[model samples]
Target: MPDLAAVADLEARLGRPLTPDEQARAGALLADASALVRDFTRQEITPVTGDTLVLRPVGVLLRLPQRPVTAVTSVSAVGPTGSVLGALSGWSWDGRDKVDLSCVSPAGSWPLSWTGPLPDTYQVIYDHGRATVPPGIVAVVCAMVLRTLLSPSMTAGMVAERIGAYNYQLQQGTGAAGASVVMTSADEKALARYGPRRFGTIALEAG
Candidate 1:
């Protein structure tokens, strides 16, 4: 995956051109920043087509791990022995990543009732993700990289020492190498919508 932000984006934020050293380091900073954001959000946040997701369905309500699912091409059930049992029907995309097995199938029957097994695995082939990266996500990535790029070498904490009126001070908001790359609480809030679903997995249905 490419870095979410670019050198141009960093230059734009800084309102000045990067020196040669800064330019050389920007790539690494951007890559680290993008990885951190993706890690925090647990999303690709990029468009993909014909993506496949496999699930050992825990319940009638199946949630796809990706976002903005545009289409479902097929669903198959595989037995515990690893043979694909057959094609599954009646599952419908719920506009996002969820699939409802309880829906009426084209054959006019609920699809949740499997003929032969406990712990059947489902393979879903689908199209999902955004056509373009969201602006907010890009902004967040830029901010994180910029912070690291511009930050002085120091950690964000308190330091105090008093010896015969000697005084020395190191400012806050600075940290060890790579410390600025962490996703802060604000970043989490900004990315909550893009993060993984919070719903608890229900026990598998065996009807």
Candidate 2:
């Protein structure tokens, strides 16, 4: 069975919601499992190489420190309503090459669409409330996203180690407020190719 499918099954078998601590552990496991599956599936291929994966750029051009050669092919945002706020085929990089999807901010002006340079790694933004999102679910998604970006040669163990570092960032409160899960790609090229597409962007309004 697929790693995600297996995770779903595990959740079902557990028969209980996960606490914060439990969620962290589960996320780590899910990350490793997903990486394994990806590697197995691509065994016949030439092996996952940085060049094999195409990274796109977005955001503003003047902001880029140096001119980029690539173009942005697609831009998408994943929210509950399924709306397309921004559209871009490519963008030039400035000093700011960061995609910030940390908190559940109000629609628009929140950079629902923009890009810059990619990072050397993936950065995850996790919100405060562990209520709706149990630790296990968070772990699974984080692992999957990281796998999607990482090269085939990179092991799941390495991903877990990176995740551990990310968790520390979360604990330090250096990330955006109320962000349950946020990820920034380390490879600037990745952002240039695949713009930020929201699978689900939750918005919270004050009463």
Candidate 3:
């Protein structure tokens, strides 16, 4: 995975050229910040292809874990021995993160007919995620990296607190380097859309 913000992005924000040491440190922090954003979002931040998943769908719909699915290449039924039994054709992609196996049947919610043991699992290969990282996400990640880069060390007591924002600034000093990086409540709210969707709600993606 690539970092959301590049070293050049950090340099642009600072409005000055980074020293060699600063560049190296900023690169490390940017990588850490990008990973943190992914952890917060709980989804892939960049486009991915040939992604595969195995599932046993319970209802007419099967929700994909990744978002903004561009294509579903294949959906196959798996036998007990994990061999590809056959290709399933009666399904549709919802254009975001769901696969719909249309109609219900006597065998189960999925429309399948068999006297032999019905397939209990399926394998789906698809392409998903954004063509470009969203600007908001990039900005947030850069901010996080900048915060950590500027204040690499912290003292014991809180320097300042913002009640409404629900954030506190730690005092920085020559005490220690590489203080733990964290996200604020505002950061969480900014990234909420990229996380897992709640039931009954649909996320629409632009084609």
Candidate 4:
């Protein structure tokens, strides 16, 4: 879940309490966020190997095979530095499924796992000297998710929070570098918290 203090900070930065009209817009954006998360979980994460990649509503769980020096490429979205995409032995999910990708690495690999989902629409491409999966696909998935979750009335603050949540999840999972996935369980919780507020606010404040 997003930090309440952080939310307040966001509002402060925006220099205003959400207007009634802004609240209405925020609510709509929240609804879009909920829907986008749902679609991404259903369409992209679930069909993949749950053993290697656990897809929950909140974020994803990835298990590294061994400790090795691996280079994560095509992570333009994360920045040019290419964050730490080392060998993860395992990771812990809040309430999502557990996936083991221990078989995917070579010997002497530094094993480590990330525990979160994507933030906004970002990607982390892993280059293992072989054709694996492109990180851009994850970015694409994130873009779709964001698009699905956005609305015209969404407040800048609310949208920022949603985007922050998304980034927080992804950052938690892959650290600075790794493949991205979604945590369906946590995401559901997020949906519950943000969804109703988003939709209900529209009705309550609109009138």
Ranking by lDDT: 3, 1, 2, 4
Candidate 4 residue runs with Cα over 4 Å from true position:
1-13, 41-207
TM-score of each: 0.73, 0.20, 0.74, 0.20
Candidate closest to the true structure, highest TM-score: 3
TM-score of predicted structure 4:
0.20
Runs in model 1 lying further than 4 Å from the true structure: 103-115, 154-171, 174-180, 201-207
RMSD of 1: 6.3
lDDT tens per residue, model 2, 1-207: 123334454455556555565455555555454444333332111111111111222321111111121222222332334333333323222223233323222334335343543222211111111123334433444444433333222332222234533532212222212212223233222223222223222222211
lDDT of 2: 0.30
Candidate 4 lDDT over 104-170, as tens digits, reads 3322433234334322112223322113323332233333233323322223222223454353222
Residue 93, candidate 1: how far off, in angstroms? 1.7
Going through the candidates in the order shown, the clash numbers are 3, 41, 0, 39
| Model 2, runs deviating above 4 Å | 1-9, 43-207
* Candidate 3 per-residue lDDT over residues 1-207, each given as its tens digit: 888878778788889888776776787787888898999887877988888777776556767778788999877776777666667776788787778876422323333444575466667788988888898898888777666666524432234446685865555443222344567677789988778776642222211
Please provide, for model 1 over 39-118, each residue's C-alpha lDDT reduced to its tens digit, 9 standing for 90 to 100: 88877777667776567655676677767777888776656655555566767777876777775243333245555543
